[model samples]
Target chain A: MFVTLWRMITFGFQNFFRNIWLSLITVLIVVLNLFLMSLVSGLNVVGQQTLTAVRQKVDLSVYFIPTTSEQRVDQIRQELLRKPEVQSIRLITRAEHLQELKKSAVDKGLVDAAIDALGDNPLGAGLVITSKTLDGYGAIANTLKDPKYQSIIEDTGNNFQTNQTVISRLSLIVNRVQVATLWLTLLFAVIAILMVFNTIRVAIYSQREEIGIMKLVGASDAFVRGPFVITSLLYGLVASILVTAVLVPILSLTNPFFAQFFAGYDINVLGYVREHLWTILGLEVAVGCGLSVISSLFAIGRYLRV
Target chain B: MVTFEHVTKTYQRRNVGLEDVSVNIEAGEFVSIVGQSGSGKTTFAKLIIAEEKADKGHITIGGWNITHIKHHEIPTLRRQIGVVFQDFKLLPKKTLFENVAFALEVAGERATRIKSVVPQVLKIVGLEQKMDRYPDQVSGGEQQRVVIARALVHRPKLLVADEPTGNLDSINAQEIIALLKKINEFGTTVVLVTHNREIVNMLHKRVITLDHGHVIADQQAGKYLL
Candidate 1:
């Protein structure tokens, strides 16, 4: 049995090299198949990361008129903080608010001159409120509309308005893209699988006479099929390695671009791949080997009757 | 060594391969099956090796009933019977040595034994010098010789040569027939299926003549009667 198995693998490699062009074509097909799949998978991961980051950055701020006393503002902060849904409430005092705007201003001289002209800070103090979820923000919005705090809180729906709109639109776009890509990936996978299957079928059909001769020479079905399976396995392994080699450099090159787009978010796809190297390779190999091997088996089956 | 009783086979539905053929080839006999094209000469050889299952009836080879031989068992049956085709059927990519050794390798023969045996078999067909050459690198006769070498590796009890000389010139055909005769002399049953009138007349062996899927004549020490 060991001898037979060893011969099968040896013959498989022998045959693979024999038809160099065909072997190369098959391997490239496998690489293309895997590359497309991994590319879409990486895109999905990045999309999810961007969406989550945007959602986390969405916060509601309740500004008080400059006349509201510190005690009154702190009281409203404490009251909002007591709500279980509110994750955090930080007080942005008028002085602190002025300092923030001035630091962020592109023209520091203009901002300093304006501050001197005003003499007293005109910026309003507010409580920046965050929630565990986007839905929790809705509850917080309702909580602020209570009649008791109406005197101190100037606007309930003012600060989070544009961000809420931006986030909802962004979420919609990302979700649509994810759905489309998932479908596109599935469609591409099916087409590629069929193409591989047909390629193998053609290869086997060309060798149909050889298969018949092998059987007549007393080779069992396993003996004949063993070599083909090994050849396909090599195709899968080589393609997976090539895809990884291709993907690592590609994702690495794209890292800078992704970082610029999703600023402060972890968009390092290469890092993601390395972190899940085993799973990624495992899945790639499984798909590659699984696809080619199955294709080869089905293709060679028609000729094994002898 | 081979028995066919009321065997019938057809292709699709209309094309008949063999029709109610009943024949028994004794052990160690040199029998030539002669017929024109589409006369079921190849079908007789295919039946013995279980390459094609009969649509009806029974077949036995060396006392084993193979009328309905299971697909898996076909290999074991074929290993015991050598078959040579007119096309040579050598793997084009494989060298002469690899081609001959393939038979044994598929049978799970050890590498050491294969290394020793393949050359001996190739030597029998006077192809030992060209053993490393691929099939396409050699002449048609040499390729057919390699097929004969492969068939001989198992020391099979029955050797079926279906149009082994069909692609060969007179000289090469004579050489292949001579080789088959030599193999038969070594106590292996040789079933030569061909349409060569001159070769058949020369063999003067037991001949089964087929026509349109039916056996029209069986002659002991037969000449090319067709």
Candidate 2:
């Protein structure tokens, strides 16, 4: 059996070299499939990171009136920190709030002049609230609504609800990104599969005489069909290496652009690929082998009825 | 030895391939099946090799009934019978040596055995010197000889030559016929299927003449009497 398998694999290579150009085209198509998948995956990771970064920025600020003492605000901050729902809360003094307002995305100089015109620190002290989980804001909202702290806590009508909406929207975008990657991968898979099927069909036609000779020589179906499977394997093997060779440099070049686009976030696509190189290669080879083998089998089936 | 009893084969389009064909050949016989195109000569050869199912008949090779041969069992039957096609059916990409070795390879023969056997067959076909040449790189006669070499690697009990010399020149055709005679002399049953009148008459062997999917004549020490 080993001998036969080895011979079949040799025959598969012989057949492969005959139509080197055609086989190269098949390898390219597989490479394109893998390339698209990797790019999409990398982009999806960056997209999720960006969305998470934005969601992390979504904090419900509880403003206490300027009359509330710094000690009292610290007490409220300590109490909120004790709750399981509250991840962390930073107490912002009136002066710190004014500084933050001056540094907002708007015209910083205009904001400073307006703050200076106020003649005193008019901004109220507040606690920037963060929840431990994405949906934990509801419980934090309930905690803030406690009767004891109600008078001190500013009546920010439904800030938790608004933050939840933003969070849910970001979650939706993340989900959409995931779904889009899946669809794009599937679409490329379908295209690659069709190319494999068509290429194998042509290969089968060219090798019909060889197949006939093989059959006449009393080759079992496995022996006759084994070469095509081997050919697909060769395609996958070669394409996998080529894709890696091409993709690594490509990811390296594109990493800078990605990092710049998602400025504050770390989008090292090349790093991710390097970390998972073997896994990516393994999955690619598996997918590539499966695609070509199944496609060749389908194309060669009806013709091998003899 | 091969036998066909009341074999009837019809195509899906209702074209008759063979009708009520019944014949038998004893061991070590050189039988030439002669007919014009579409006269079931190829069909007769196909049945012997189990390449085509006998729609309604009992077909056997050396007493093994293969009329209803299963799809998976075809390779086994074919291994025992070497078939030489008129087209030679040599893989164009493979060298003559590899072509011959491929036959043995299919049977899962070991490298040592294949190395030992392939050269001997190529020598028998007088192609040992040109064994490395691809089919397109060789003359038609040499290619046909390569096909014969490939067939002989199995040491098949029965050798079926379906128009084996049809693509050759007169001299090459005669050489192929001479080679088949030589193989038959070694106690192998030979079934030569052809329309070439000269080959059949030269053979002066057992002749089975087919016409319109029926055997109209079967003569001992016969000529091409179509």
Name the top DockQ candidate: 1
Off by over 4 Å in 1: A64-95, A104-125, A130-136, A148-151, A158-167, A260-266, A270-279
Put down candidate 1 lDDT per residue, B89-206, tens digits, no spaces: 9888888899888888888888899999888888889988999999889998888889999999989999999999999999999999999999999999999999999999998899
Of all native A–B interface contacts, model 1 reproduces a fraction of 0.91
Residue B115, model 1, lDDT: 91
The sequence of per-residue lDDT tens digits that candidate 2 reaches over residues B113-215 is 8888888889998888888888999899998999888888888889999999899999999999999999999999999999999989988899999999999
lDDT of 2 at A91: 91
Best by TM-score: 1
Q: Candidate 2's residue-wise lDDT over A1-306, tens digit each? A: 788778888888976788788788878877787666666666666666666676677677888877788889999999889988788899999888777877774888777677679776766789988876666776787777787777877656576568667776766776787688678767765776677667667767777766777787888888889888888888878887887788888878887887787776655667878998998888778877777788788877776877
Candidate 2: the clashing residue pairs are: none
- What are the models' TM-scores? 0.90, 0.89
Q: Which candidate comes out best when scored by lDDT? A: 1
